[model samples]
Target: MPKKAKAHASRQITLSELVTIQAGYPFRGSIQENPDGDVKAVQPRDISDLGELSADKLITTNLTGKRKADWLQQGDILFISKGIRHFACYVPEDMPETTLAPSLFLLRVKPEYQGQLNPEFLTWQINQAPVQRYFDNSAEGSRQLNIRKPILAAAPIAVPDIETQNTIARLYAASLRENALLHRLIHNRQQQLNAIANDLISHS
Candidate 1:
Protein backbone atom coordinates (compact mmCIF):
# COMPACT_ATOMS: atom_id res chain seq x y z
CA MET A 1 0.00 0.00 0.00
CA PRO A 2 1.13 3.56 -0.73
CA LYS A 3 2.08 5.79 2.16
CA LYS A 4 -0.47 8.51 2.91
CA ALA A 5 0.70 12.12 2.76
CA LYS A 6 1.04 14.05 5.95
CA ALA A 7 -0.75 17.39 6.31
CA HIS A 8 1.37 20.43 6.88
CA ALA A 9 0.51 23.66 8.64
CA SER A 10 -0.36 26.58 6.38
CA ARG A 11 -1.02 30.27 6.82
CA GLN A 12 -2.96 32.76 4.75
CA ILE A 13 -1.15 35.92 3.70
CA THR A 14 -1.55 38.63 1.11
CA LEU A 15 0.38 38.31 -2.16
CA SER A 16 2.19 41.62 -1.67
CA GLU A 17 3.87 40.18 1.39
CA LEU A 18 5.27 37.23 -0.55
CA VAL A 19 6.27 38.80 -3.86
CA THR A 20 7.04 42.15 -5.44
CA ILE A 21 4.49 42.77 -8.16
CA GLN A 22 5.61 44.94 -11.05
CA ALA A 23 3.79 46.08 -14.15
CA GLY A 24 4.90 44.69 -17.53
CA TYR A 25 7.07 46.66 -19.93
CA PRO A 26 5.19 49.64 -21.28
CA PHE A 27 5.75 49.42 -25.03
CA ARG A 28 4.60 52.57 -26.80
CA GLY A 29 2.28 52.61 -29.84
CA SER A 30 1.75 49.64 -32.13
CA ILE A 31 4.08 46.70 -31.65
CA GLN A 32 6.30 46.46 -34.70
CA GLU A 33 7.67 42.97 -35.11
CA ASN A 34 11.34 42.75 -36.04
CA PRO A 35 12.84 39.40 -36.86
CA ASP A 36 16.32 40.72 -36.10
CA GLY A 37 15.34 42.19 -32.73
CA ASP A 38 17.32 41.15 -29.67
CA VAL A 39 14.52 40.99 -27.13
CA LYS A 40 11.36 38.88 -27.23
CA ALA A 41 8.14 40.36 -25.84
CA VAL A 42 5.40 38.11 -24.44
CA GLN A 43 1.81 39.04 -25.19
CA PRO A 44 -1.40 37.98 -23.45
CA ARG A 45 -2.13 35.59 -26.33
CA ASP A 46 1.20 33.83 -25.82
CA ILE A 47 0.01 32.33 -22.56
CA SER A 48 -2.41 29.38 -22.46
CA ASP A 49 -5.36 28.84 -20.07
CA LEU A 50 -3.39 25.98 -18.48
CA GLY A 51 -0.69 28.40 -17.26
CA GLU A 52 1.78 27.54 -20.00
CA LEU A 53 3.69 30.42 -21.62
CA SER A 54 5.05 29.75 -25.09
CA ALA A 55 8.45 31.30 -25.65
CA ASP A 56 8.32 30.31 -29.31
CA LYS A 57 6.94 32.72 -31.92
CA LEU A 58 6.86 35.68 -29.49
CA ILE A 59 7.00 39.23 -30.82
CA THR A 60 10.60 40.29 -31.32
CA THR A 61 11.23 44.05 -31.17
CA ASN A 62 13.95 46.55 -30.41
CA LEU A 63 13.69 49.41 -27.92
CA THR A 64 14.95 52.68 -29.32
CA GLY A 65 13.97 55.03 -26.52
CA LYS A 66 15.57 55.54 -23.07
CA ARG A 67 13.13 53.24 -21.27
CA LYS A 68 14.87 50.79 -18.94
CA ALA A 69 14.15 47.10 -19.52
CA ASP A 70 13.34 44.53 -16.85
CA TRP A 71 13.87 41.09 -18.34
CA LEU A 72 11.83 38.12 -17.27
CA GLN A 73 13.80 35.62 -15.19
CA GLN A 74 13.42 31.97 -14.27
CA GLY A 75 10.99 31.19 -11.41
CA ASP A 76 9.17 34.46 -12.09
CA ILE A 77 5.39 34.41 -12.24
CA LEU A 78 3.45 36.17 -14.97
CA PHE A 79 -0.15 37.04 -14.19
CA ILE A 80 -2.77 38.31 -16.62
CA SER A 81 -4.37 41.34 -14.97
CA LYS A 82 -6.14 43.03 -17.87
CA GLY A 83 -8.30 40.17 -19.13
CA ILE A 84 -11.55 38.77 -17.77
CA ARG A 85 -9.70 35.54 -17.06
CA HIS A 86 -6.79 36.07 -14.65
CA PHE A 87 -4.16 33.34 -14.83
CA ALA A 88 -0.63 32.94 -13.43
CA CYS A 89 2.26 31.02 -14.98
CA TYR A 90 5.82 30.31 -13.88
CA VAL A 91 8.76 31.25 -16.07
CA PRO A 92 10.84 28.17 -16.85
CA GLU A 93 14.59 28.26 -16.40
CA ASP A 94 15.08 27.90 -20.17
CA MET A 95 13.66 31.37 -20.91
CA PRO A 96 15.75 33.83 -22.90
CA GLU A 97 15.93 37.65 -22.84
CA THR A 98 12.19 38.26 -22.76
CA THR A 99 9.81 40.94 -21.52
CA LEU A 100 6.07 40.82 -21.02
CA ALA A 101 3.48 43.20 -22.49
CA PRO A 102 1.65 45.81 -20.38
CA SER A 103 -1.45 43.65 -20.03
CA LEU A 104 0.36 41.30 -17.64
CA PHE A 105 2.00 41.68 -14.22
CA LEU A 106 5.38 40.26 -13.28
CA LEU A 107 5.63 38.74 -9.83
CA ARG A 108 9.03 38.01 -8.33
CA VAL A 109 9.18 36.29 -4.99
CA LYS A 110 10.81 38.57 -2.44
CA PRO A 111 14.35 37.64 -1.46
CA GLU A 112 13.28 37.12 2.11
CA TYR A 113 10.34 34.94 1.08
CA GLN A 114 12.17 33.11 -1.68
CA GLY A 115 13.27 30.24 0.53
CA GLN A 116 9.88 30.05 2.19
CA LEU A 117 7.69 30.36 -0.88
CA ASN A 118 8.08 28.35 -4.07
CA PRO A 119 7.26 30.15 -7.35
CA GLU A 120 5.45 27.16 -8.82
CA PHE A 121 3.42 26.78 -5.66
CA LEU A 122 2.50 30.44 -5.73
CA THR A 123 1.57 30.16 -9.41
CA TRP A 124 -0.64 27.16 -8.71
CA GLN A 125 -2.28 28.94 -5.78
CA ILE A 126 -3.07 32.03 -7.85
CA ASN A 127 -4.85 29.88 -10.46
CA GLN A 128 -6.95 28.00 -7.94
CA ALA A 129 -10.75 28.35 -8.01
CA PRO A 130 -11.03 30.34 -4.76
CA VAL A 131 -8.34 32.86 -5.70
CA GLN A 132 -9.72 33.08 -9.25
CA ARG A 133 -13.17 33.78 -7.86
CA TYR A 134 -11.70 36.59 -5.77
CA PHE A 135 -10.13 38.10 -8.86
CA ASP A 136 -13.35 37.74 -10.82
CA ASN A 137 -15.36 39.52 -8.15
CA SER A 138 -12.90 42.36 -7.64
CA ALA A 139 -12.21 42.95 -11.33
CA GLU A 140 -13.34 46.36 -12.67
CA GLY A 141 -14.28 47.96 -16.02
CA SER A 142 -17.42 47.55 -18.12
CA ARG A 143 -16.22 46.55 -21.56
CA GLN A 144 -13.44 44.37 -20.23
CA LEU A 145 -12.85 43.25 -16.65
CA ASN A 146 -9.43 44.10 -15.26
CA ILE A 147 -7.70 43.27 -12.02
CA ARG A 148 -5.93 46.37 -10.80
CA LYS A 149 -2.40 46.16 -9.45
CA PRO A 150 -3.50 47.02 -5.96
CA ILE A 151 -6.19 44.36 -6.10
CA LEU A 152 -3.74 41.76 -7.34
CA ALA A 153 -1.18 42.65 -4.71
CA ALA A 154 -3.80 42.46 -1.99
CA ALA A 155 -5.00 39.01 -3.03
CA PRO A 156 -4.66 36.31 -0.38
CA ILE A 157 -2.49 33.21 -0.71
CA ALA A 158 -2.07 30.16 1.47
CA VAL A 159 1.53 29.42 2.24
CA PRO A 160 2.73 26.10 3.55
CA ASP A 161 6.19 24.85 4.52
CA ILE A 162 8.81 24.69 1.81
CA GLU A 163 8.75 20.87 1.71
CA THR A 164 4.99 20.70 1.33
CA GLN A 165 5.07 23.45 -1.25
CA ASN A 166 7.71 21.62 -3.28
CA THR A 167 5.66 18.43 -3.25
CA ILE A 168 2.48 20.18 -4.38
CA ALA A 169 4.31 22.19 -7.02
CA ARG A 170 5.90 19.05 -8.40
CA LEU A 171 2.53 17.31 -8.64
CA TYR A 172 1.01 20.32 -10.41
CA ALA A 173 3.91 20.46 -12.86
CA ALA A 174 3.52 16.76 -13.68
CA SER A 175 -0.20 17.21 -14.27
CA LEU A 176 0.46 20.06 -16.71
CA ARG A 177 2.93 17.89 -18.62
CA GLU A 178 0.46 15.03 -18.75
CA ASN A 179 -2.29 17.34 -19.97
CA ALA A 180 -0.10 18.66 -22.78
CA LEU A 181 0.86 15.13 -23.81
CA LEU A 182 -2.81 14.09 -23.94
CA HIS A 183 -3.65 17.11 -26.12
CA ARG A 184 -0.88 16.22 -28.56
CA LEU A 185 -2.00 12.60 -28.67
CA ILE A 186 -5.58 13.63 -29.42
CA HIS A 187 -4.48 16.05 -32.15
CA ASN A 188 -2.30 13.40 -33.81
CA ARG A 189 -5.12 10.87 -33.69
CA GLN A 190 -7.49 13.37 -35.33
CA GLN A 191 -4.95 14.03 -38.08
CA GLN A 192 -4.58 10.30 -38.64
CA LEU A 193 -8.35 9.97 -39.04
CA ASN A 194 -8.44 12.93 -41.44
CA ALA A 195 -5.68 11.35 -43.55
CA ILE A 196 -7.59 8.05 -43.72
CA ALA A 197 -10.79 9.88 -44.77
CA ASN A 198 -8.88 11.76 -47.48
CA ASP A 199 -7.42 8.49 -48.80
CA LEU A 200 -10.89 6.90 -48.96
CA ILE A 201 -12.27 9.94 -50.85
CA SER A 202 -9.41 9.74 -53.40
CA HIS A 203 -9.90 5.97 -53.84
CA SER A 204 -13.68 6.45 -54.36
Candidate 2:
Protein backbone atom coordinates (compact mmCIF):
# COMPACT_ATOMS: atom_id res chain seq x y z
CA MET A 1 0.00 0.00 0.00
CA PRO A 2 2.73 2.47 1.02
CA LYS A 3 5.57 3.45 -1.32
CA LYS A 4 8.28 2.34 1.12
CA ALA A 5 6.49 -0.97 1.68
CA LYS A 6 6.61 -1.59 -2.06
CA ALA A 7 10.31 -0.76 -2.24
CA HIS A 8 11.44 -4.18 -1.04
CA ALA A 9 12.20 -6.80 -3.69
CA SER A 10 9.17 -8.86 -4.64
CA ARG A 11 11.14 -12.09 -4.54
CA GLN A 12 9.76 -13.97 -1.55
CA ILE A 13 11.83 -17.08 -0.78
CA THR A 14 11.83 -19.85 1.81
CA LEU A 15 14.70 -19.72 4.36
CA SER A 16 16.04 -23.13 3.29
CA GLU A 17 16.81 -21.83 -0.18
CA LEU A 18 19.49 -19.42 1.04
CA VAL A 19 20.98 -21.16 4.04
CA THR A 20 21.93 -24.54 5.49
CA ILE A 21 20.29 -25.06 8.88
CA GLN A 22 21.76 -27.36 11.49
CA ALA A 23 20.79 -28.04 15.08
CA GLY A 24 23.36 -27.01 17.70
CA TYR A 25 25.72 -29.52 19.31
CA PRO A 26 23.82 -32.44 20.82
CA PHE A 27 25.65 -32.78 24.10
CA ARG A 28 24.25 -35.62 26.19
CA GLY A 29 23.05 -34.69 29.69
CA SER A 30 23.55 -31.27 31.23
CA ILE A 31 26.67 -29.46 30.09
CA GLN A 32 29.27 -29.42 32.85
CA GLU A 33 30.57 -25.90 33.43
CA ASN A 34 34.32 -25.56 33.95
CA PRO A 35 36.14 -22.47 35.19
CA ASP A 36 38.95 -23.00 32.72
CA GLY A 37 36.88 -24.59 29.98
CA ASP A 38 38.01 -24.70 26.40
CA VAL A 39 34.80 -23.47 24.78
CA LYS A 40 31.90 -21.16 25.48
CA ALA A 41 28.37 -22.60 25.46
CA VAL A 42 25.46 -20.49 24.22
CA GLN A 43 22.19 -21.26 25.91
CA PRO A 44 18.78 -19.66 25.27
CA ARG A 45 19.32 -17.27 28.18
CA ASP A 46 22.40 -15.86 26.45
CA ILE A 47 20.12 -14.33 23.82
CA SER A 48 18.22 -11.15 24.57
CA ASP A 49 14.55 -10.46 23.83
CA LEU A 50 15.69 -7.91 21.23
CA GLY A 51 17.52 -10.72 19.40
CA GLU A 52 21.01 -9.76 20.52
CA LEU A 53 23.35 -12.44 21.83
CA SER A 54 25.20 -11.68 25.08
CA ALA A 55 28.46 -13.45 24.52
CA ASP A 56 29.95 -12.49 27.89
CA LYS A 57 27.30 -14.37 29.87
CA LEU A 58 27.81 -17.62 27.95
CA ILE A 59 29.02 -20.38 30.24
CA THR A 60 32.37 -21.97 29.55
CA THR A 61 32.39 -25.76 29.30
CA ASN A 62 34.93 -28.39 28.35
CA LEU A 63 33.34 -30.16 25.41
CA THR A 64 33.59 -33.96 26.06
CA GLY A 65 32.51 -35.95 22.99
CA LYS A 66 34.72 -37.66 20.45
CA ARG A 67 32.70 -35.98 17.68
CA LYS A 68 34.26 -32.82 16.27
CA ALA A 69 32.59 -29.68 17.58
CA ASP A 70 30.76 -27.48 15.15
CA TRP A 71 32.20 -24.16 16.26
CA LEU A 72 30.07 -21.07 15.57
CA GLN A 73 31.38 -18.85 12.83
CA GLN A 74 31.00 -15.19 12.03
CA GLY A 75 27.85 -14.29 10.10
CA ASP A 76 25.98 -17.30 11.45
CA ILE A 77 22.43 -16.94 12.71
CA LEU A 78 21.23 -18.56 15.93
CA PHE A 79 17.54 -19.37 16.07
CA ILE A 80 15.84 -20.29 19.32
CA SER A 81 14.17 -23.60 18.45
CA LYS A 82 12.49 -24.27 21.77
CA GLY A 83 10.91 -21.60 23.95
CA ILE A 84 8.01 -19.18 24.14
CA ARG A 85 10.05 -16.68 22.09
CA HIS A 86 11.33 -18.03 18.80
CA PHE A 87 13.67 -15.24 17.74
CA ALA A 88 16.91 -15.28 15.75
CA CYS A 89 20.23 -13.64 16.75
CA TYR A 90 23.21 -12.70 14.59
CA VAL A 91 26.66 -13.93 15.58
CA PRO A 92 29.20 -11.15 15.46
CA GLU A 93 32.67 -11.56 14.01
CA ASP A 94 34.54 -11.35 17.31
CA MET A 95 32.85 -14.36 18.90
CA PRO A 96 34.76 -16.59 21.30
CA GLU A 97 35.56 -20.22 20.50
CA THR A 98 31.93 -21.12 21.05
CA THR A 99 29.33 -23.81 20.39
CA LEU A 100 25.67 -23.54 21.24
CA ALA A 101 23.39 -25.87 23.17
CA PRO A 102 20.85 -28.04 21.34
CA SER A 103 18.07 -25.56 22.04
CA LEU A 104 19.24 -23.38 19.14
CA PHE A 105 19.37 -23.92 15.39
CA LEU A 106 22.45 -22.62 13.61
CA LEU A 107 21.95 -21.10 10.17
CA ARG A 108 24.85 -20.50 7.84
CA VAL A 109 24.44 -19.02 4.39
CA LYS A 110 25.07 -21.55 1.67
CA PRO A 111 28.29 -20.96 -0.27
CA GLU A 112 26.41 -19.84 -3.35
CA TYR A 113 24.27 -17.33 -1.45
CA GLN A 114 27.02 -15.93 0.76
CA GLY A 115 27.36 -12.43 -0.69
CA GLN A 116 23.74 -12.23 -1.84
CA LEU A 117 22.26 -12.61 1.64
CA ASN A 118 23.28 -10.74 4.80
CA PRO A 119 23.19 -12.68 8.08
CA GLU A 120 22.04 -9.67 10.13
CA PHE A 121 19.21 -9.06 7.69
CA LEU A 122 18.14 -12.67 7.90
CA THR A 123 18.15 -12.48 11.70
CA TRP A 124 16.00 -9.33 11.68
CA GLN A 125 13.61 -10.86 9.17
CA ILE A 126 13.13 -14.01 11.20
CA ASN A 127 12.39 -11.92 14.30
CA GLN A 128 9.86 -9.77 12.47
CA ALA A 129 6.18 -9.87 13.40
CA PRO A 130 4.98 -11.80 10.34
CA VAL A 131 7.66 -14.48 10.53
CA GLN A 132 7.29 -14.75 14.32
CA ARG A 133 3.56 -15.24 13.85
CA TYR A 134 4.25 -18.14 11.53
CA PHE A 135 6.54 -19.72 14.13
CA ASP A 136 4.02 -19.09 16.92
CA ASN A 137 1.25 -20.77 14.96
CA SER A 138 3.38 -23.73 13.92
CA ALA A 139 5.01 -24.34 17.32
CA GLU A 140 4.00 -27.48 19.18
CA GLY A 141 3.63 -28.21 22.94
CA SER A 142 1.23 -27.03 25.64
CA ARG A 143 3.67 -25.66 28.25
CA GLN A 144 6.91 -24.90 26.40
CA LEU A 145 6.48 -24.31 22.67
CA ASN A 146 9.01 -25.83 20.28
CA ILE A 147 9.66 -24.79 16.68
CA ARG A 148 10.45 -27.68 14.40
CA LYS A 149 13.18 -27.37 11.79
CA PRO A 150 10.70 -27.97 8.98
CA ILE A 151 8.52 -25.08 10.10
CA LEU A 152 11.53 -22.76 10.33
CA ALA A 153 12.92 -23.90 6.99
CA ALA A 154 9.54 -23.31 5.37
CA ALA A 155 9.23 -19.78 6.80
CA PRO A 156 8.82 -17.19 4.08
CA ILE A 157 11.46 -14.47 3.89
CA ALA A 158 11.18 -11.34 1.79
CA VAL A 159 14.54 -11.07 0.04
CA PRO A 160 15.21 -7.49 -0.85
CA ASP A 161 18.30 -6.26 -2.72
CA ILE A 162 21.62 -6.41 -0.86
CA GLU A 163 21.70 -2.63 -0.35
CA THR A 164 18.24 -2.55 1.14
CA GLN A 165 18.95 -5.53 3.34
CA ASN A 166 22.15 -4.02 4.66
CA THR A 167 20.48 -0.69 5.36
CA ILE A 168 17.62 -2.33 7.21
CA ALA A 169 19.95 -4.51 9.24
CA ARG A 170 22.11 -1.56 10.24
CA LEU A 171 19.10 0.45 11.29
CA TYR A 172 17.77 -2.46 13.33
CA ALA A 173 21.12 -2.83 15.10
CA ALA A 174 21.25 0.90 15.88
CA SER A 175 17.74 0.70 17.29
CA LEU A 176 18.66 -2.14 19.55
CA ARG A 177 21.57 -0.16 20.97
CA GLU A 178 19.30 2.85 21.52
CA ASN A 179 16.79 0.64 23.30
CA ALA A 180 19.45 -0.75 25.61
CA LEU A 181 20.75 2.70 26.42
CA LEU A 182 17.29 3.95 27.28
CA HIS A 183 16.63 1.00 29.58
CA ARG A 184 19.94 1.56 31.35
CA LEU A 185 19.19 5.23 31.79
CA ILE A 186 15.82 4.45 33.25
CA HIS A 187 17.32 1.96 35.66
CA ASN A 188 20.00 4.40 36.81
CA ARG A 189 17.43 7.16 37.37
CA GLN A 190 15.30 4.81 39.46
CA GLN A 191 18.30 3.89 41.57
CA GLN A 192 19.18 7.56 42.11
CA LEU A 193 15.62 8.33 43.18
CA ASN A 194 15.65 5.45 45.66
CA ALA A 195 18.95 6.62 47.12
CA ILE A 196 17.62 10.17 47.53
CA ALA A 197 14.45 8.92 49.21
CA ASN A 198 16.43 6.74 51.58
CA ASP A 199 18.70 9.65 52.49
CA LEU A 200 15.71 11.91 53.19
CA ILE A 201 14.00 9.27 55.33
CA SER A 202 17.14 8.68 57.37
CA HIS A 203 17.63 12.40 58.01
CA SER A 204 13.90 12.87 58.93
Candidate 3:
Protein backbone atom coordinates (compact mmCIF):
# COMPACT_ATOMS: atom_id res chain seq x y z
CA MET A 1 0.00 0.00 0.00
CA PRO A 2 1.22 3.51 -0.76
CA LYS A 3 1.95 5.80 2.21
CA LYS A 4 -0.56 8.60 2.73
CA ALA A 5 0.61 12.16 3.16
CA LYS A 6 0.18 13.58 6.65
CA ALA A 7 -1.81 16.76 7.03
CA HIS A 8 0.06 19.76 8.37
CA ALA A 9 -0.85 20.80 11.88
CA SER A 10 -2.72 24.10 12.06
CA ARG A 11 -5.14 25.79 14.39
CA GLN A 12 -8.62 26.09 12.96
CA ILE A 13 -10.87 28.77 14.35
CA THR A 14 -14.21 30.25 13.46
CA LEU A 15 -13.99 33.87 12.38
CA SER A 16 -16.12 34.91 15.33
CA GLU A 17 -13.53 33.55 17.72
CA LEU A 18 -10.75 35.65 16.25
CA VAL A 19 -12.57 38.92 15.83
CA THR A 20 -15.55 40.95 16.97
CA ILE A 21 -17.94 41.49 14.09
CA GLN A 22 -20.28 44.43 14.20
CA ALA A 23 -22.79 45.70 11.71
CA GLY A 24 -22.09 49.12 10.29
CA TYR A 25 -24.08 52.20 11.19
CA PRO A 26 -27.43 52.72 9.51
CA PHE A 27 -27.24 56.34 8.45
CA ARG A 28 -30.63 57.98 8.12
CA GLY A 29 -31.64 60.72 5.71
CA SER A 30 -29.89 61.80 2.55
CA ILE A 31 -26.13 62.14 2.15
CA GLN A 32 -24.76 65.63 2.17
CA GLU A 33 -23.74 66.83 -1.32
CA ASN A 34 -21.08 69.05 0.20
CA PRO A 35 -17.66 67.41 0.20
CA ASP A 36 -16.73 69.20 3.38
CA GLY A 37 -19.41 67.50 5.47
CA ASP A 38 -18.58 66.30 8.95
CA VAL A 39 -18.01 62.65 8.12
CA LYS A 40 -17.09 60.60 5.07
CA ALA A 41 -19.39 57.55 4.88
CA VAL A 42 -18.26 54.50 2.95
CA GLN A 43 -20.98 52.81 0.94
CA PRO A 44 -20.97 49.43 -0.77
CA ARG A 45 -20.45 51.16 -4.10
CA ASP A 46 -17.16 52.55 -2.85
CA ILE A 47 -15.71 49.03 -2.51
CA SER A 48 -13.95 47.68 -5.56
CA ASP A 49 -13.70 44.08 -6.80
CA LEU A 50 -10.13 43.88 -5.55
CA GLY A 51 -11.29 44.83 -2.05
CA GLU A 52 -9.90 48.34 -2.41
CA LEU A 53 -11.87 51.37 -1.22
CA SER A 54 -12.53 54.13 -3.74
CA ALA A 55 -11.89 57.33 -1.83
CA ASP A 56 -13.41 59.48 -4.57
CA LYS A 57 -16.79 57.79 -4.34
CA LEU A 58 -17.29 58.09 -0.56
CA ILE A 59 -20.26 60.26 0.40
CA THR A 60 -20.19 62.84 3.12
CA THR A 61 -22.43 62.46 6.18
CA ASN A 62 -23.57 64.66 9.03
CA LEU A 63 -22.89 62.32 11.93
CA THR A 64 -22.33 63.98 15.28
CA GLY A 65 -19.93 63.39 18.18
CA LYS A 66 -22.34 60.99 19.89
CA ARG A 67 -21.65 58.49 17.11
CA LYS A 68 -17.90 58.66 17.34
CA ALA A 69 -17.60 54.92 17.93
CA ASP A 70 -19.29 54.35 14.58
CA TRP A 71 -16.27 55.80 12.83
CA LEU A 72 -13.79 53.31 11.34
CA GLN A 73 -10.22 53.33 12.58
CA GLN A 74 -6.95 52.25 11.05
CA GLY A 75 -6.59 48.44 10.62
CA ASP A 76 -10.36 47.98 10.65
CA ILE A 77 -11.54 45.53 8.01
CA LEU A 78 -14.76 46.31 6.23
CA PHE A 79 -16.76 43.41 4.84
CA ILE A 80 -19.69 43.78 2.47
CA SER A 81 -22.45 41.86 4.20
CA LYS A 82 -25.15 42.17 1.60
CA GLY A 83 -24.86 42.10 -2.17
CA ILE A 84 -24.11 39.78 -5.09
CA ARG A 85 -20.45 40.73 -4.94
CA HIS A 86 -18.64 40.66 -1.64
CA PHE A 87 -15.47 42.51 -0.62
CA ALA A 88 -13.15 42.78 2.39
CA CYS A 89 -10.94 45.84 2.60
CA TYR A 90 -8.40 46.94 5.20
CA VAL A 91 -8.62 50.52 6.40
CA PRO A 92 -5.28 52.21 5.95
CA GLU A 93 -3.76 54.43 8.63
CA ASP A 94 -3.78 57.44 6.35
CA MET A 95 -7.47 57.11 5.53
CA PRO A 96 -9.51 60.10 6.61
CA GLU A 97 -11.96 59.73 9.45
CA THR A 98 -14.80 57.70 7.95
CA THR A 99 -18.03 55.95 8.85
CA LEU A 100 -19.42 52.77 7.43
CA ALA A 101 -22.78 52.37 5.72
CA PRO A 102 -25.38 49.83 6.84
CA SER A 103 -24.54 47.26 4.20
CA LEU A 104 -21.07 46.57 5.57
CA PHE A 105 -19.65 44.74 8.57
CA LEU A 106 -16.71 45.99 10.59
CA LEU A 107 -14.31 43.30 11.76
CA ARG A 108 -11.78 44.04 14.46
CA VAL A 109 -9.46 41.51 15.96
CA LYS A 110 -10.04 40.69 19.58
CA PRO A 111 -7.44 42.41 21.74
CA GLU A 112 -6.05 39.16 23.10
CA TYR A 113 -5.81 37.52 19.69
CA GLN A 114 -4.26 40.48 17.93
CA GLY A 115 -0.82 38.98 18.19
CA GLN A 116 -2.02 35.64 16.83
CA LEU A 117 -3.92 36.86 13.81
CA ASN A 118 -2.88 39.46 11.26
CA PRO A 119 -5.59 41.89 10.16
CA GLU A 120 -4.41 42.04 6.55
CA PHE A 121 -4.18 38.25 6.43
CA LEU A 122 -7.72 37.87 7.70
CA THR A 123 -9.01 40.35 5.13
CA TRP A 124 -7.18 38.63 2.32
CA GLN A 125 -8.34 35.19 3.45
CA ILE A 126 -11.96 36.29 3.54
CA ASN A 127 -11.64 37.58 0.00
CA GLN A 128 -10.12 34.34 -1.23
CA ALA A 129 -12.05 32.31 -3.79
CA PRO A 130 -12.95 29.50 -1.41
CA VAL A 131 -14.26 31.85 1.22
CA GLN A 132 -16.16 33.89 -1.35
CA ARG A 133 -17.80 30.70 -2.62
CA TYR A 134 -18.73 29.82 0.92
CA PHE A 135 -20.41 33.18 1.31
CA ASP A 136 -22.24 32.76 -1.96
CA ASN A 137 -23.50 29.36 -0.89
CA SER A 138 -24.59 30.47 2.57
CA ALA A 139 -26.09 33.80 1.58
CA GLU A 140 -29.86 34.29 1.62
CA GLY A 141 -32.44 36.39 -0.27
CA SER A 142 -34.13 35.58 -3.55
CA ARG A 143 -33.24 38.61 -5.62
CA GLN A 144 -29.86 39.55 -4.17
CA LEU A 145 -27.69 37.45 -1.91
CA ASN A 146 -27.30 38.83 1.60
CA ILE A 147 -24.66 37.53 4.00
CA ARG A 148 -25.88 37.81 7.54
CA LYS A 149 -23.72 38.31 10.61
CA PRO A 150 -24.17 34.76 11.77
CA ILE A 151 -23.11 33.38 8.43
CA LEU A 152 -19.96 35.47 8.47
CA ALA A 153 -19.22 34.49 12.04
CA ALA A 154 -19.51 30.83 11.23
CA ALA A 155 -16.98 30.93 8.42
CA PRO A 156 -13.94 28.74 9.02
CA ILE A 157 -10.39 30.07 9.07
CA ALA A 158 -7.03 28.42 9.33
CA VAL A 159 -4.75 30.00 11.88
CA PRO A 160 -1.22 29.26 10.97
CA ASP A 161 1.89 30.30 12.88
CA ILE A 162 2.50 34.02 13.25
CA GLU A 163 5.53 33.92 10.98
CA THR A 164 3.61 32.22 8.18
CA GLN A 165 0.69 34.59 8.54
CA ASN A 166 2.97 37.61 8.32
CA THR A 167 4.69 36.24 5.24
CA ILE A 168 1.40 35.59 3.46
CA ALA A 169 0.07 39.02 4.38
CA ARG A 170 3.16 40.73 3.02
CA LEU A 171 2.89 38.78 -0.23
CA TYR A 172 -0.78 39.68 -0.54
CA ALA A 173 -0.02 43.36 -0.09
CA ALA A 174 2.69 43.20 -2.74
CA SER A 175 0.28 41.54 -5.15
CA LEU A 176 -2.24 44.30 -4.61
CA ARG A 177 0.39 46.94 -5.41
CA GLU A 178 1.41 45.09 -8.57
CA ASN A 179 -2.18 44.85 -9.72
CA ALA A 180 -2.76 48.53 -9.09
CA LEU A 181 0.25 49.44 -11.20
CA LEU A 182 -0.94 47.16 -14.00
CA HIS A 183 -4.36 48.77 -13.92
CA ARG A 184 -2.82 52.24 -14.20
CA LEU A 185 -0.67 51.15 -17.13
CA ILE A 186 -3.67 49.75 -18.91
CA HIS A 187 -5.67 52.92 -18.32
CA ASN A 188 -2.85 55.14 -19.64
CA ARG A 189 -2.46 53.02 -22.75
CA GLN A 190 -6.18 53.19 -23.43
CA GLN A 191 -6.11 56.99 -23.12
CA GLN A 192 -3.18 57.18 -25.56
CA LEU A 193 -5.10 55.01 -28.02
CA ASN A 194 -8.14 57.26 -27.75
CA ALA A 195 -6.02 60.34 -28.36
CA ILE A 196 -4.42 58.77 -31.47
CA ALA A 197 -7.82 57.83 -32.81
CA ASN A 198 -9.06 61.40 -32.36
CA ASP A 199 -5.99 62.81 -34.13
CA LEU A 200 -6.39 60.42 -37.08
CA ILE A 201 -10.06 61.33 -37.41
CA SER A 202 -9.22 65.03 -37.51
CA HIS A 203 -6.59 64.49 -40.26
CA SER A 204 -9.05 62.46 -42.35
How does each model score on lDDT?
A: 0.88, 0.89, 0.83
lDDT score at residue 64, model 1, on the 0-100 scale? 51
Candidate 3 residue 57 Cα shift, in angstroms, is 3.9
Off by over 4 Å in 2: 1-6, 94-96
Which candidate has the highest lDDT of all?
2
Instruction: List TM-scores for all candidates, in order.
Output: 0.93, 0.93, 0.89
Q: In order, how many clashes per candidate?
A: 0, 0, 0
lDDT of 2 by residue, 33-135 (tens): 9989989889899899999888878888987766677788899999999978898999987565799888999999999987889899899999999999998
- Candidate 2 vs candidate 3: the TM-score winner is 2
Please report how far candidate 1 places residue 109 from its true position, in Å: 0.6
| Poorest stretch of ten by lDDT in candidate 2 | 1-10
| Cand. 1 Cα-lDDT | 0.88
What does candidate 2 score on TM?
0.93
